[model samples]
Target: MEAPLVAALGALIAVVEACGAAVVVVGALSGGPARRARS
Candidate 1:
């Protein structure tokens, strides 16, 4: 009962963190070239 709920919440948090990291990585990669070009 409680164990399953805790597991589910942990999984959800892990997924969200992974997604956030991916977005940050992608944003940095996409921004890098533009920033270099401007300079």
Candidate 2:
């Protein structure tokens, strides 16, 4: 039981970190274009 719980917690933490990285990448991409095209 404990092992399964630990695995689940670790997986959840990994997912959150991955999502945060993805969000940061997306924000940078969007901001770059918007800034460059600001006529």
What lDDT score belongs to each candidate, Candidate 1 first? 0.98, 0.97
Work out candidate 2's RMSD over C-alphas. 1.3
Task: Provide TM-scores for the models.
Answer: 0.86, 0.82
Best by lDDT: 1
Candidate 2 per-residue lDDT over residues 1-39, each given as its tens digit: 799999999999999999999999999999899999995
For model 1, the superposed segments whose C-alpha errors exceed 4 Å read none
Q: In model 1, which range of ten residues has the least summed lDDT?
A: 26-35
| Model 1, C-alpha of 24: deviation from truth (Å) | 0.5
lDDT of 1 by residue, 1-39 (tens): 899999999999999999999999999999999899999
What's the C-alpha lDDT at position 14 in model 1?
100
Off by over 4 Å in 2: none
